[model samples]
Target: MSAHQTSSPAAEAGDPPPVPEATRPVRARRLPPLRRGLLVPAALPIAVGLWIASLPRVNVDAMGDLGLLQVLPVTYFAALGLLAVGFLAVLREPRVRQPWAAGYVLALITVIHATPSALYPALRYAWAWKHVAVVDAMLRHDGAVPHSGTLDIYNQWPGFFQLNAAVLRVTGLHSVLGFASWYPLLANLLLVGPLLLLYRSVTTDRRLVWGGVWLYFSVSWVGQDYFSPQAFAHLLYVTVLALVLRRLADRRRAAAAGTPSARRPGAFVLVVVLIAAIVCSHQLTPLMLITTLLLLAIPRRNRRVVLPVLGVAVGLTFLWDSTVARPYVSTHLSDLIGALATPDRNATSGLAGLGSAAPGQVFASWVDRSLTATVFLLALVAVVRHRWVRRTGLPLMLLAPLVMLPSNNYGGEMIFRVYLFALPAAAFLVATLLVPPWPHRRWRAYASGLVAAVLLGGLLFGYYAKENMNRFTAEEAAATRFVTSVAPPGSRIVSVTSSLPGGELGYDTHERLVLAQDPLDQRRLLLTDPLAVLQSTMDDPRITGPTYVILTRAQEAESRLTGVFPVGTVGSVRAALDTSTLFQRLYDGPDAAVYRYIGPGARPSPPGSVQP
Candidate 1:
């Protein structure tokens, strides 16, 4: 028979001929998943490096914009676009012991999120100053300070500050400032891998797990992840939740096998201790975390973890508040009770209070709401449409943080934070829309992956765009440094609001805050009706000592955008200061100004104050 002819009897009987061995297409063994997706992820580092290198070390631009989005080099967007490419490419990888593509995608997500911290010349946010001051105090005093009735919360939650002090002490960096500026980037980078561990516990689908993690980072517009106790505690919180989920899965398997409970009691104790640590470290995170844990355990009938953890949290909260935070706790107890008592009112206030403030703020509020609602809507659709019963704890976890919403206003951001806590689960559910564990057609899979990317990128853009005006500036930081260094201790420094002058510094001793919001404190100045507040503070005899009034570019932006001060009010105040002889211009930087009131009968400070 010819080479192309049938060689067997079966082929000869009206059967197709078998092709010669040499003619057959060589079977191409597919490349391993890691190497298949390796090009993009590997190039991702190069692209990020180039992007960061090309980016001019940014301080806030003249307009007081962190200028993150506006001044970002083209490479910045190119890097983000490349990351999205790598993410989509990874989705095509087959499920195996490890989805290597997911790892690549995770790395990219972190690099993108950490960019602001990496690009900035100095630490930007105002709260970070307070945190730095607290750590400075800890390093100076050798330990936590006792209560200062109405000052910073460091007196109450000193663990994070103490930890920062320890880091400074160990690194001999002099101040956490060096670390603080880059802390957000570092915190975000650290958060990525561990978050995957938590997601893995909640879902077996590798795609869903990766997508959920990606989604969480993409929509992180709340900016609560700044270098603060909340950020630190949140990292711990994710770790604790992941551990509990892992253990619960293991214990269930053991139970099914009729094996004796192995170290279940020990695990319970460990979780309780972790909860205690969280309680000590953050004011609100522990409560949110506990609510989540209890919700998880209650539905699963797993009492061991929640029972002891909740008990420990309660006792620690009470003991700590009753002793260390006594003045604060006693003063706010009734108010806390009142807020918690009318949760419906508080919930509305928390979620809707900031929406009407400014055009930019309104846009931000809508973007945030839309991002959350989109993910949640996706999750709900997945829940209703998917026929297979996913036996994950995510459903119940979604309801848990809602229970914490009644706790307090948390300065009108309580709901924002609650959504943040629920994001992992919501992201998981959103991923479920595309994450079918079983294999499917390539086109369908790729289409879903593209959809996921679009959803994520849109949310991320929303997250970044909304903060166009709020990024703190370098000049404000300089003014803060100068004031903190030059101002005589026990001197009163009044500010319109905390958004500028980085009011967080010298909060306790070197300076006293007379904010309009704090009527109880005589020194607390007002942001609104600048002239009236000024005249009142200056004319009042109690303010005999010299007082400095500050106005910074960032504060002006904040006041304008958030409507904290009326439009052009910052300039109006400054103009008033410039015209009035009563207030002497002590030191004026391009972006920040310091004025000392030399009213009649006020003793003059030594001439020539220090300048930054």
Candidate 2:
């Protein structure tokens, strides 16, 4: 029969003819419910158990140049591997389960971030300790810390501290130290919600959405998720952007439906409140938020939703900077101007040379660079190959922060900040590449798992490579506390480096003199005749009170890691003080020592009569 005569009745009724068997679409295979249920449920607990089993084996003292990576047991990596494999397996299923994917992401965050809290006796990172001190000062001064000296920046943008103070008051917790150790884990968990919101706004595919979230945590090696104002402000910043992006998506839908956009005053108010919170809490994040919002608004279709948020961010930032943060801005205005004047320098300032870093640290730094480049490369490929990513404006969002790189060096951290702000978009783009819109082959799952493992390795190396400098010993804490407790107000507290935990405990009461910041000649003097440098600093007429010199293991690690001083500068200086009769040994411990500079004419204390 002729082809037309052989046509089906359905075709005659204007329905399409039956597809040939060769061209028929095949249903993707899915894992059986029973198998999936058992496997996915068991994966998380096993991974958690492995991680827990691995922590005790980590000897923080014996950690080498690679930091925690050197000390972490093989089981820890096994845990990470198991999670990566399980996550990829789940994603490979024809029907991705949200709960299983989210569970794996949460597990990844916990495994990565909770390690420090579990292993370290005290909080990690000196800056976190300093922030705790800021909270203490705020509580003492009733929401305002006066005479904050170098740390006055915290007081200028006191919103974060004030919030912590209020929390302390409400919870009756003496200090943030009580929970600061776990802040990294909690902050990362808090980020997941907004990330889901942001990713969902752009795409409905669960695999892409959850894969991006997993990738985000996997490569977020910046270590900015610690207990700091930046961490808190970043959470709020992400939330604001997610809400704004959702609004943008809504506007597009409304226009498509031929309906004028509806104004949701509540949502707008919420965005303003979050923007205000972000501006008041952190300095850099507000600028980033404003830049991103302005870029989103550049598309005429998005201006109606994005412009208002951008305006609010700008106005709040201006009001806070001109009013509350005026002191810091005015004082640093020239430096900021100088940074802006030299755009090339601003762009390259954050890139530190590896000449001075330890051999292992140099390797870790290269790993970090490689990981960053890999992510950018994947995103670039996605942009070139996938029209959906470009159509959705994700590339624009990802590249928006590049404009800020030449604006200010941000104390040589602008490059890092740009990467951080660009990370969300980059993660989504990378996810599109790994988990494409169309299904292809089993090799895709293997490729995803392989890439994830590489990124995770990079994350581990990059994030933990400098833990020797970031981690503080109990002795270091105790010695710092002892000095702060005994040293009189206005006394000069000196350290070879600022890596001592609790170094800023009495920031308002004591004067700080970090020898690391000393002039080149003075640092050289410190290397040769530490006595003269200590004596001169102690005898400075402006320092009318006693002077305490603190040397810590972390300080030595920092010196060696950054080449701020000679590799054994701390040890040599400690040795000099130990043998010298001019300086009194106030307190001595294995990991740290405290020395007081008495006048040259004064006799030393009797042997074994050192103060505690």
Candidate 3:
């Protein structure tokens, strides 16, 4: 042997020739299965235990403008920390463990999303209760809600309500309210599968895949996951995107192998079905889907597969808008066109001024803004640093929804919807910055865990900070029920805002008016002379039947937090009603009150007297 070829002890002993260090493959050190399995299992119970113990300590009634964050115990935050550390530790294992990572993600979802449902006695969001009312309308009218007034939009896009109506009938349940509070938890859980499919299709790195999933849930503080059509349609939208991307991946692999790509007729059919469902369920998601597909089709390699799906989506959306949704579309056509001309307004419409919001709410809003900016900043860094992200069209997907920002504000919620649709791609891109494809030092795990903690901290604030307004009390629900039951069809119901629970219970039969949503001049009049505004609304020629005004804690909270009315508007209005004989108190409670307006010429009644 040449002197340059140094012989090792193994070679001297007649063992196989020693492999050269430079040419040898390196294997990452993996955690033992026993250790990996025990970490998450132990952490899960501790986190869950901490959460359960903290629940009883929550004071829902005492929640201030900061919402759940103001009332949630320190133990709740401690639980989140433990879960974050456990997830990071398990994720850093050289060979990522699927079950452990998924378990931590699911546990986080439970602690964050399920806490509100558990703490609040009644359903949380007023919009969710309104959606339940839509389902009730469907059940009452035998699957058709005619003359739904402004709520006719729900009638036009009735797929979500129809599905719930069927579920209620099949299960023999009386109302969606039974399971509505849990919908956030359920909707988030349903997202896990498609998220996995999407991340895996784009990359083979397990760390990136699971990290993206964790980050998706951590920063998804947009409160759109309530029991609404948009939430359901969003699930369908993510599923369709996942399947299409998987197909793209398959075709890419087949081309590299120089093999004929097999046709996936079944998958194509499934994608079409999901797209149709999305088109029918919500008006906005379909447009989002089409924009995303058109962007995905920009690459020549992806065009063949993507253009067909895009065609179907566009056709279905056009057909739906031109037919069943025509009334709403035609009515709002000019406004939509006008919105397209003012992209700046469309983009900034959802960003209300913080000066009028409560101090705590202002802080919460800033936290949400910081969190969203951080996610996008990190994703943008990933795009600049990682070529594969752009190559895979992830950036395109992340930015495609921006196109809608210049089209229509979607009633001032277009910004949030854009964030919602863009989150999946943004999450994965951000994960690429934190979770390396190959094993590294222990400090990376700690650093990633620290980032996770900050993201979750922001998430808690963004999601629960408005619970003071979002949550409805049992008394509020009862008051709304009483008003709905006693008022005859064609009666008018007025409220400080639409935040009252069950406010839309009989929306089809009642003409509803929100003082906060009134014309600018009228809303200003409310701040000055609320009683006069109420009296005028009652005496309007259009309101031929009974007129009732509802004042509730949730409405007051919403008015204060959103600056829809001055700080003490609801209270001042209530006091005015109490002093005036023209208004008769029908139902009064600590959390809510209902008052009926007597005719202007009726004789004045004694104070504190209830009309028979």
**Candidate 3 lDDT (Cα, whole model)?**
0.84
Candidate 3 positional error at 172, Å? 1.7
Winner on TM-score (1 vs 3): 3
Ranking by lDDT: 3, 2, 1
- Can you tell me which runs of candidate 3 are displaced by over 4 Å? 1-38, 600-612
Q: For candidate 2, give the lDDT.
A: 0.83
Q: Model 2, 1-612: lDDT tens per residue? A: 211112444334322132221222558567445335566777778988999999888888988788998889999999999898788767766567788898899999999999988888889998899999999999999977777788888878888889999999999989999899999999999999999988887766677789899999988998899889999998998899899887876666565556787889999999999988888889999988888888887778777778888889999999999999998999999988887789998898878656887889888888988898898899899788764455565777788889899999887888878888888889988887786333446666677778878888999987899999999888888899999998988799999998989889988888889998899899888888888888888667877688889999999999888778879999999999898877888888889999887776888777366566
Give me candidate 1's TM-score against the actual structure. Answer: 0.84
Colliding residue pairs in candidate 2: none
| Backbone clash count for every predicted candidate, in the order shown | 6, 0, 0
Across 259-282, the per-residue lDDT of candidate 1 in tens digits comes to 765776666666777777777788
lDDT winner, 1 or 2: 2
Off by over 4 Å in 2: 1-24, 27-38, 603-610
Models, CA RMSD each: 9.3, 5.9, 6.9
Q: Give the whole-model CA lDDT for all candidates, comma-separated.
A: 0.64, 0.83, 0.84
